[model samples]
Target: MFLGLDVGTSGVKAILVDAEGEIAAAATTPLSLETPAPGWAEQDPEAWWAASCAAIRDVLARRPSARVEAIGISGQMHSSVFLDQRGAVIRPALLWSDGRTTAECREIVTRAGGEAQLRDWVCNPALEGFTLPKVLWLRNHEPQGFARLAKVLLAKDFVRLRLTGSIATEPSDASGTLMFDPANLRWSREMLDAVGLPLSLMPDVGGSAEVLGRVTPGAGKLARLEPGTPVVGGGADNACGAAGVGAITPGEAVSSWGTSGTVLAATAQPRVDPGLRAHTFCHVAPGVWYVMGVVLSAGGAFAWYRNQCARELAEEARDDILVDEAAAIPPGAEGATFLPYLQGERTPHRDAGLRAAFVGLSLAHSRAHMTRAVLEGVCFALRDSLEILKALGLAPAHLLLTGGGAKNAFIRQLQADVFGLPVTTVNREEGGAYGVALLAAVGAGAFPDLQTAVQRTLARRPPTPPNLDIHRAYEEVYDRFRKRLVAART
Candidate 1:
């Protein structure tokens, strides 16, 4: 058996996979986020360690007799975890959704000469969510914390450190930092020097599936695993999620709508978006790269609507009630258009200050109409990146839909209608945990590489082809949505 751990924003999930790429057991432990001020998202690093251990133990308890071979980890990317010389966490880690670094993003671009030179160095623009800007925020706002910072690690790397006492990172997560050169597959000295930070603060970079270290004795007891269980350097959640759905080569893509939404396409090379709209990052699969567009609020937008307008349905554990309500509305939501930029956006707009709104709302519009529009808006935001991918010649034949919203037929159809493309789901859609488990299989010498592992494991359902009539209707609604985005700048 191989273990895979994903340290996510909301929780830590652990899964165990048997040989032949089958899951033996899985478990998750919930985590909480702290937003003490507007636009600031933080989490206690120690809580991550606690939740990871709890989840690992929960899963292992299910099959105590199973012999574990190796472990792999996947996690949310672009978050910053600061540590002191003693390796104690210096402060609550800044999260990817945190938008407190707007000024720092501008500062990074200025320091790098401009957005053009910044993209030239890192293959991405300076975005508030990226680690580079978060680092600058620390220096500018909390100089004392900056002085105490001995090292910085991405979310999963910190968990790996607790598990194995090793300091390392893989390229997939590193590429999101705006301090990594995806084209060169290394830390960008240009960006580092421009920010006045040292190379020593970063973890050593390695291939995603490489065995970084064995489980330490202390961590082994806590996780209920044997000491010396090998641990592989896993991947960022999106890269691992892409791998899980077998989006490992050109001509393939994935569209996921969790709290956030993203459209990812694997490429043979790093393809920088000239407009700096989409991100080009390293894939967990060696020698492969991917272009991804991020929507800061996707399913999250729907959840917010549910909490504010339909709390009873949510509290009753019937989110499908929402689907039933929204599905009854027409394709265009009766002229209502929702802009799901609640937490700012990362893709085409690159605007962290953008807010969300319902355009053309009136007394005639009900919660159901707005709900349908919210769903449509989320899918359209994903399509924004799909359009960019198409322009870059990285278009996939179809999109593989995954995440919390993918389970509902209504959402599946809504995505197809808005994107004007066939979409499908895979049987093994356990997100990052399943993908890292497969990576662990490769690291444990059970497979030659990730490509062979995925091809052997993945089985796709029939495609959900787009409804041409509804797709036409969405074209008009999406146009309204694009035009109304200006209203969200407030």
Candidate 2:
């Protein structure tokens, strides 16, 4: 059996898969975020370790006779975890959704000569969500912590460090740091120098599926596993999510709607957007790359609405209540529009200071109308990335839709209408954890390569075709929404 652990923003998930890619047992332990100040999102590294241990122990207990030969990890990308000389976590780890580094991002661009030069070097604009900005923020804000910094690791690598006593990261996660070159598949020395950081502060980079080390005796005890279990270098969450859905080949794409929304297209080459509107990063699959567009608040916006306005319906499932209310409203929400920038944005506009609002609201607009508007706004935000990808000549024939938002029929149809393309959901819609489990399968020699593993495990469903009339009607609404968003940013 192979084990896959995903250190997600909201929880830690552990799953065990057999040689044939069938899951034996899966478990998840919930995690909480700390926001001491505005725009600052954090979690204790120790909390991650504790959650991981609990999840792994539960999974093992469920299948007492299962012997795992190898392990693979996947995690949220671009977060910073600082380790002191003794390998102790210095502070709470910063999260990708955190927006506390706007000035630091600007400083990075300035040091690199300009936004253009920075994008030229890293294939992405230096944004607050990237890892380099978080490192710089620590250096400037807490000089004492900076003085003790021995190594900086991304979310999963830090967990991997605890499991194997190895300090290393994979290309897919490293490429999102704004300090690595996706084209060359290495850390950019010039980028490190531009940020006034030394190469020693970063972990060693490795292939996504390469076996890094064995689980140490100490970690084995906590995780309820034998020592010396091999651990593979895992991938960034979205990269692994793409792999999970069998979207690794060119012409395939995955649109994920979690706390954040992501539209990623697999490609043969590193496809950079000329305007620095999208991010080009290394794919976990060997010899390939992907371009991604992100929406900072997608399902998160709907959750906000449910918490604030629909609390009375909390006895029922929130999504079910939301869908029932929203399904009755028309596609355009009767001219009401919502801007889903509750945590700033990444794609199209890299503005970290942008805020969300409801436009064209009136007494005639009911709570149901607002509910549909929120769903429509999220779909429109996703389409922004689709538009950028099409501009870069990386359009996909269909999008493999995954996450909570994909479960609702109304929202899925809305995505189809907004994107003007077919949207699909696969049989194994397990997201990142399932993808990394397949990576473990490769590392364990269960399959010859990733493609064969995907073929054996993944089953596809028919595509949800778009309604052309709704698609045509949405064009004008999208244009008006885009114009208002640009105006609001100014």
The local distance difference test score of each candidate is 0.89, 0.89
- Kindly list the per-residue Cα lDDT of model 2 for residues 1-490, writing each as its tens digit: 8898989877999998888777889999999988887667899988888898899999999999999988999998998999999999999988898899999988998899998787778899988999999898899999999999999999889889999999999999999999999998888998999878999998899888899878999999999889999899989999998898898988899899877899999999888888888999999999889999999888778878888988887656876977888899877899889999987889888888888888889999999999988998998999999999998888888889888767778778889999999998878756898899898888888888889999998988888999999999999989878877963454
Question: Candidate 1: which pairs clash?
Answer: none
Q: For model 2, which pairs clash?
A: none
In model 1, the runs with Cα more than 4 Å from the true position are 314-316
Model 1 Cα lDDT, one tens digit per residue, 369-469: 98888888898899999999999888777899888756888899888888888999988768888899889999989999999999898889999999999
The regions of model 2 sitting more than 4 angstroms off are 486-490
- After superposition on all CA atoms, what RMSD does each candidate show versus the true structure? 1.2, 1.5
Q: Which ten residues in a row have the lowest lDDT in candidate 2?
A: 481-490
**Model 1, residue 435: displacement in angstroms?**
0.8
